[model samples]
Target chain A: MNQLNSTQLETLRNDLKARGLSLFVLKDELLDHICCLIELEMEKGISFDEGRQIVFKNFNSAEMLRNQKKTKWIYQSKKFKRKFKSVLSAAAVIMLMMVGGVEAQETPDGHPIYGDCELASGFGIRRDPIYKIKRMHSGIDFKAKAGTPVVATADGTVLEAVSNPDGYGNKIIISHSGEYKTLFGHLSGFNVKTGDKVRKGDIIGYVGSSGRSSAPHLHYEILQGDKKINPELFISK
Target chain B: MYSKELMKGTLKTIVLKLLKEHEKMYGYEITQKVKDLTQDKIQLTEGALYPTLHKLESLGYVYTEKKEYNGRTRKYYLLTESGQAEATEKINEFAEFVLTMKFIFNSKLAAE
Candidate 1:
């Protein structure tokens, strides 16, 4: 592992403090990741001056910081508190069942449903490609030109496919078994409706820049129970 | 880059020495002290410093206390018992390294 000199270390320390990162709160791995990124950028023909600028640009941006802060907050949020209680309750029930020698229920398969469209934008800090200010892009954006096919990401029953003003334009939410749910947002139009049984990769809607969007794209998300894990974790690159 | 790398290698020593003398420090204050003591030769950035502090904390070499100042919360890091022992070892090691390098360089200069 490459180590930084005292001077370089000091520079890094100041930069992080300026960006509101509490040194005491940061884990070693996260710090190593940031250092690796800076080193990589430096290797990419970028001067130290330019590398620092780019690194700060990427790390200090509102979108990225917001997500980082949100992740931290989620771990300390009321929602997490409630979920923790529920998990404890469920564990107690399961333990009682086990003591009674009852077989535990089997969880359903979680094969991912492929989308019918191509990607437009990824989850991260990006200039709204339309709006100038930084916006928290909560999901992946897919390209399915207006009226082009958008498909379900998994085997699920359509919970809602309707037009609304939340800036998702026309959107759909599917609830799969095992508390796994998928959302397809910013559609130009929809081909399914509430309570509709949809198979994996089934066409459900078409992409459009609807409610609060600047252009045509589908905002996609996957949720397990109530927690939103990174959709890219499941999607094929 | 070489100088930076060398400085980084001895960071534990420098931090331990400072804490041994001053007792405790927050992130910003530590960086400032390094810069001042080095006569501006060394400048630690926040990006690199926090991670090191955290690593030290995880290793039980240091501990932290959160304090409020200027309406903002700041975490100050202090060396632990193990950290003090390790710091002494590091200082000895560094001193030996400097002496050996100086001897080698002096011999080369004399031969030339």
Candidate 2:
């Protein structure tokens, strides 16, 4: 393996610093990773400049910055955990769970389904599709045809799988670990019943325009305790 | 290459398992090892790999050592004793996941 010269390493370090990688640890790992790629290309008879370009092309600065933020977040949380361990009470533990839950969801590890499905509505307040009035949209709506398979986003046991003629139609809520729960609403039918253990990506139901829906779509919600969060946070793009 | 979505959840376990076997490795070597082990089917991007590594370190599952090689310094990571236990737990969890997936697929086929 070819070693990068001091001048070359300095240049790479400056480049990373300019890209907003202020975290020293992440900067070091990324610098080494890039250098290794460049060295391999150099072994293939590529010039230093060309190897640098080829290696840099694989990186997205924005994504790199996001990774840095996530790492910092986790580090800070660990520090907080250590600081509070001696004084931890029931209330403090719940607060830590909330903090950990949000940080843990930095990536969409358990996407509900495969294939492209247009997002009809996002989380937060929006014009109600059926009522035509602004209301809180507790979940994200993905426009899918009726009978499309809706999968669970994480491994959990079913909390509810009931049919209704009015609201949500046929809905299923899977209570996962870490005090997190996922709700898949407006389904045409259920593949699993209440109390069934379902893994991530298991088909929980089919898309349908059940109760209070204007069209066929999957309304998905991620809940931390009783509070509903944006489903988009857990849906891998 | 395997889809990023499919590989996302497994990177921590993979890295921990590798460290359990190899004692210590650096960022670049970890990527190359995964590529070689999976026959180039699972390519780990640096964006995904580094955060996972840092998380392991923060969680006390691993620790890093800096060494000079040639003109520059290289960082090597190795699992802590607790990390060894974590590796066993993760590997078993993943093995059970595989069984669950197989059962789901087989039952689906039977239903059809």
Candidate 2 lDDT, tens digit per residue, A1-237? 677899998888888888898696677777888888899999999888899888878777788888889988888888888877856786688889878876554222576755557888899999887788999999888998888888888778899999877888898988887668888888988999999998778888899999888888888888888999987776663
What local lDDT score does residue B51 receive in model 2, on the 0 to 100 scale? 89
Q: Which portion of correct inter-chain contacts appears in model 1?
A: 0.02
Window of ten residues with lowest summed lDDT in model 1 chain B: B66-75
> Model 2, which residues run further than 4 Å from truth?
A86-237
lDDT of 2 at A59: 75
Compute the interface RMSD for each candidate structure.
Answer: 11.1, 1.3
Q: Superpose all Cα atoms of candidate 2 onto the true structure and report the RMSD in Å to 1 decimal.
A: 23.1
Residues B1-112, candidate 1, lDDT per residue (tens digit)?
Answer: 2375886687777777787777888766787788888888877655455546665765678888876442234577899999989878888898999999999999999999
How many clashing pairs in candidate 2?
0
For model 1 the local lDDT of residue A218 reads: 77
Over 4 Å off, model 1: A1-24, A27-237
- List of clashing residue pairs for candidate 2: none
Query: DockQ for each candidate?
Result: 0.05, 0.42
Report lDDT (CA) for all predictions. Answer: 0.68, 0.85
Docking outcome class, model 1: incorrect
